[model samples]
Target chain A: MLLGVNHKTAPVEIRERLAFSNDPGVPYRELKAIPGCEEFTFLSTCNRVEVLFVSSKGDETERKVRDFLFAGSMSYDEAGKYVYLYKGEEAIQHLFRVGASLDSMVVGEPQILGQLKDAYRTSSDQSCTGVILNRLLHKAFSVAKRVRTETAIGSSAVSISYAAVELAKKIFGNLKGKRAMLAGAGEMAELAAQHLLNQGIAEVVVANRTFERAVNLARCFNGKPLAFEELVPELAHVDILISSTGAPDLILHKEDVKPIMKKRRNRPLFLIDIAVPRDLDSKLNDLDNVYLYGIDDLNNVIDINKSERDKEAVRAERIVTEEVLKFMLWLGSMEVTPTIVALREQAQEICRDEISRTLANCKDLSPKDQKSIEKMASAISNKLMHHPILFLKGEDAPEDQRRKLAIFRKMFSLDSVSRQDNGESD
Target chain B: MGDLLFKGTFLLYLLSTIIYSVFFFSQNKTVRKTARMFLLGAGIFHTIYLIFRYFEAGHTPLTSNHDIVSFFSWAMAWGFLSFRWRYQIKNFGSFVSILITLQLIVAAMSSSEVRELQPELQNILFPIHASIIITAIAFLAMAFCGAIMYLLQERELKSKRFGFFFSRLPSLDALDTLNHHCLSIGFPLLTLGMITGLIWSKQVFGSFWSWDPKETYSLITWLLYAAILHQRFTVGWRGRRIAFFTIIGFVVSLITFWVPSYHFTGL
Candidate 1:
């Protein structure tokens, strides 16, 4: 069933309005209210809002989902444009893309995949996913895997944290024995510091507005922790410096660093001013060997990585498309197999009963005659069913024949055959 | 100990470079893989050949202008091999292979006249310095890969074009981190190597900070990383800017190695 709202459907306010509440049992209650509903999963992230369900009523059950999303407090007219509906195959593909990070606000983000899995697990734990949803979720996992393996999208480094380390290596020919200072200890700064550590920068010092955040981030990246105020005094000790904070304007200006540069005897300092409104003063680049690059400058690296990895995108797309087609073929084949099984089992049951009754009625018949009668009945059933089952195996079988088989199963009261044999229905 | 092995390996690297360049432009995946494998094989053979030459002279192979340059290329090839082996990255190995091959070609051009091993080169400490220095450069080679990634990433963003190389390269953050991590490990190793070198120099030359071309270049390389570390920690420079400098620094270090040896008449 379709259940997602994005930038197209909802504004930031509306999306945030329908975002996940602290209440944990809301999913179960909402899903339980839908008719024929057997599964309930919701994936809510910064870029998307989704509610996945398994209901035989399908689109007819949309009203309940609508009510759950808006709580019927307002009209759908205001926010409906931002929503796109998907069902069956389309819905499955959407979920797969979402999980694979292809549909993410930032493509190739690894977080969405884990979030989708968590949502799915929550539904499963609440006894929401029935046979249909179970198959759908499993299929989503495979599609995600196929995307990851066949595409280079996931390999490129796009985030700010990685870009920081790349810059560090640039200023320094080699990272060996270099020292780094991470100021503000914002998640961004911490992440950047981690990248610095990974780039082979040995000594790392984290200084944050709050001492504890610095300590925590330092501990996470295995860097030496420092205090916030210690930044100015220790400025000369570091080779590369990263800063991110909530300060509205320039916390580090040319004035603050000019003296440090002089004291350091003109040794270069590569400063990464990553704050949105800008952290360091732009004029600081005037200093010799003092390379200051901003968040936008990181785009250059991001673009290049995006292209290099994009070269493999065609290969990955072909894989996903082929897999989807293969899945559809298997799904198509499944319909015929069930009807054939239903027909054969019914015919076999009748043969056994009739043969046993005949043997009982003729008490004078010898054991050899009875055995022969049973063998003959079995042979007739096998020979009768062989051609029909073989025809079902054809990938390009006639639609009329397929439909007729379905009608036969329905007429014979065997439409609800065992579902255990179903395979790869995406 | 003969010049033929050195020349032969140099030729092999040269051949691999052409093959890799062809594969890159032509989009020949099979040929690219083959060329990289060939480069790796050449590197292996080159290592054996260098070791034999080192033994023959009863000194480190990095003693002369010829062998040190050759060793630098050898280190780079080994670096490429390790990076490819660790990541199983199939396509980009050729880029670094070409670079390493060129390094060896330059080394081959330098005088390989086989001068007598000097008394300063007599100590076992000499060989230790050679190994550490080569190892440090090898790590830098991985850093170079990161730099290439950074440059490629920036170009893609500017052009608004994304392709296979675009995504295959590690993330801007990942590459930066990789560059940083590689440098961190390599820097310390280099520090120890430099320390050992200083101790040996002090014992032999009666001085530790002579500012020889090799020593000066090493300091400059160290200072470049020092600046990177400072900027990353103090300010927030990253990605392409960082990568550009990392690449430049490594290239300069390469030049420094070659230029100074020629002055010292290791050529």
Candidate 2:
């Protein structure tokens, strides 16, 4: 049973209360106690909260999770219309689509993909993802990659880092000679710097714990390398501050940046905190001209980009579907291959058996003659396999033979196993 | 040995064009594959033609507009091959085949009036100008495809006409990125070509600033392309609007390329 409310269903107020991440195993532990719940996963985001579980009693399991999430806060009836439910293959397809990021709030948003994988991994660690869900998740990832490579779906991610630079460009007209400072030189910080430099940012300052590594990284981007202690001093001069550091402690305390903020005399400062534990102080957002953006705040820009991406997505989808269908048809034809092999082996066994029997009766036959008969029998098998092998391979197949091969898959249990996967997984 | 193969290849482009048209209508994967293989084969044969023609002429292939166009189309197909391996864009082979075939037709028509290489103009810098310019145009062709796709995708969006292809196409982000990438790579190349062309003219003609039809048009085309690139990256213009400007730029290039040639007046 897959049950939840997202931006598609519930309002933001309900979604926020019900939103529960399972990284700490809190929701997973609580969910396992529900009656008839054999396996479960908790999917939580700013816009949606979903509970995917395996249960014969799908309705009861969904209700229990729904109630557990809300915890006697609001009436179930008020939330009922917003929440959705899916069971069996539909549930499988939903989860796969979600994993593929196709059903994401922002179509082709990549965060949900990593998040979904983490959720699946967490649930699997807790022994919640059964065969069905495991297969579904894996297939979803493959489809996501297919959508990425095959179709130009995610060809350009249009990430928040990109949008941040775009916003800066709108403010400054051009990035040439613009001063940019990176608080932490992590992936997001690097990406933001790269985006800035691509627009011709004149001077970029990298501030990190190890100044040597920072210097090395700065050289790659042709930027300045500054010590971590130099951050506040350098912050007053820089135009953009993107904080993405791995330190557990708060690197930029509110007071620490407040002095620099005042020293700049109301100069516009864009602070984007993409780090997981958030390097910048959130209170700094209240300050004037200090445009601070967290992961959630990026949704607005991401949504705009998504809408734009959604427009050109039409042709990409056509190309993807055509490729997907082509790939599926080719993949589906793989079932009869084993049968084709088996049949050839069966024919060869019969020939070998008969040849040995004949050899036993002719005791006067030399070893060389016996070996010749064996070779002849094997040759017969090889010759007979030639056509079927080619047919199975889509090689010069007569129209009817191709049709027969398709039929052969049906005759065997080819799709029964794969159809359960709904063509999402490998 | 190479002559028969080259002639067969020139004929093969005619057939390849028809095959590509069939694939466009049918959308048959097999037909598409056939068109791709055939185009690749034709490109190989055309390459042989150019190489042998270079030997036969006892000079480089960029002797006239005819050689430049043919050689440009060849390099363009090679560019497509490089992109096709990574991008795998559907129906591109069809589009590329039509483009290359049109170029081939124009080149073949002009092939009858081949001129011997002028001694003063036979420096390596001239070929550098020709090579960079042709390769830059190939990148422009890529941008052209991206623009076409952008318009089609935008029209589909405005119309809300979601169909089988509605989901398969590259997103606006992809198209815009592709367009920008082409401009970024092509712009420098175009600049280098222009600079080399100027140097070559100074060496051969003893003046860099003569407003020859080719020179004037090339500069005009370059400026237009430059404007589009500037607007896209700096002005944040994208999607349908950028598509219009990109095509406009390419048209300016084509006119500057084909219209002023002696083919129109001499014929």
Candidate 3:
């Protein structure tokens, strides 16, 4: 059983109250007493609060889990309006979709996969998840990987920082040995700086009007701090320049950049001015090898990327359906696999018993003749079992197949033997 | 056999032109690679055709307009391919292959019939002068293509709407650098070709500086390239300004090849 409140159904205000604590001990203890809940795990993220559990009571599990989540905060009837419940195959499909990021607000975003893995790890550490969930979550991870490779969902940039990295790629072609200069320590600039660093930029230069602030920002990024007056000379050494100074007058003008183009020997320079009043003059855009994008330009590119991702999301949804079907088929075969294994073991046991009886009665006969007779008996047993095994595994319609399996199990008394196999420890 | 090979080269270039245009408009990497392969095939056939024509003509096959045009087309294809390999600018071929196809078609249309050699054109230096000038034009052709791409990419960047042109064209720096590199390569070649022609004229016409129309136009083309290079190095004139002049220089060189020949009885 799976009970959850996602962005689609719940307001963030309520979600924040019911959201699970990062420490699993609180939620594990809280959910432990839910009647008939044999095992369980809690998944809480900014966009969702989901409780997945193994329960015998089916529909009642949803009520118990929801009541526990909103225990003293709200009444059952009030919280019920925000929660969605699923059971059996529906619950499995929901988990798969969430793990694959198909259910994310920004569909195909990669963060959800990591979050799901973190939840799985926490549940495993708490020993709250048993065999069924262990297999399901591992399978979900593989399905997510397949979705990532088989679709173009994660290839395009859909955020401001990602768009900045993409634009840098468009200008520099590669970022392996490039340098980035950050003119100010605005929040957006810091985010873009981190992205550039992740892309393998060799060094970073931080420049600001306030010397101590620049030094602080530089220390945070582990970059070199440049005096504000050294901005012109520093421009020659960097391939990417992001200016977000909050100055009324332009921090960068055409004349300041024009000479840098020559000193840089025509190497490309990508300028991103993300300041509110615009840190760089518009005229600086006309410089020969300098590519400049103001705040609106980056936002426009991000918008385009978002629309492109929305288109690819449709294709990603189809992949999810195909993967879910594959998982379901494998699950169906799981029940049959154990039954077939037990039946084969029972038949081989009967053949061995009869062969030993014949050998004891024929003790006066030659030893070689006794061995040949034993081999013959084993061959006959295998040939006799092959037909029944093939019939059991054949692709008949689901309803007819279930009826056939029941009759076959009863006629052969395989159910009693399977029950004994299960009771071995008992 | 010569005519058949020439036609084959012409048709192959036309096919590659279509392929490159498709690659440019669609911006698909697979189509770009396929177009590059088709171009390589065409270039191979073109080389074979040139060798065959050289054997048939008995001379160097650089004197007549038909041979000059064919040689020019081959040089453009070779130069573009080399640049594409070195720089990995696959989409730039869309504009350049079209230019190559047009040049080949003009070559196919011109008379390939071997005319009796004019007495003044029979010197060994005639082939040298023609070969250098044609090769110089090939380099200038690359510069010309780079200029057009620079303008288009600049327009897209300044407008702040990145569309097909923005995605397909190489960066502004790449195009500008290509223009500068081509000019550096072509200027020296042009100067050497003029020097060879000066020596040839002194031997045949008894005057190194003849006021012939061909001589005057070659001088004008040279001066234009020299000015472009000088401004680029000293005054830091680049990007759109340099691209515009490189394009103009290529057109004037074309005239120096075709128009001046009509003015002279034979040179």
Candidate No. with top lDDT: 3
Best by TM-score: 3
lDDT digits (tens) for residues A185-231 of candidate 2: 65556667766775678888888789886886676567888999888
In model 2, which regions exceed 4 Å deviation? A1-426, B1-3, B14-31, B163-168, B259-267
Candidate whose DockQ is highest:
3
Query: On residues A44-134, what C-alpha lDDT tens digit does candidate 3 reach at each position?
Result: 8767889888776766767778888887799988888999888877888898889888887555667789888988898788777765577
Sorted on lDDT, highest at the top, how do the candidates line up? 3, 2, 1
Q: How many residue pairs of model 3 clash at the backbone?
A: 0
Best-first order by DockQ: 3, 1, 2
Model 1 regions more than 4 Å off: A34-36, A56-60, A72-84, A87-90, A153-426, B1-267
Name the lDDT of candidate 3. Answer: 0.80
lDDT of 1: 0.69
Q: Residue A127's C-alpha lDDT in candidate 2?
A: 85
By TM-score, the candidates rank as 3, 1, 2
RMSD of each: 11.4, 17.8, 10.7
Q: Residues B1-267, candidate 1: write the lDDT tens digits.
A: 467777678777877888887776676778777787778778878988987886786666677767776777787777667766665443456567667776676776777766776777787787787778767877777788768866776565334345656544544445666777767766777777888889888888888878777788888887887787677666655666677878887786666555654224552
Error of 1 at B112 (Å): 8.6
lDDT of candidates 1 onward, in order: 0.69, 0.70, 0.80
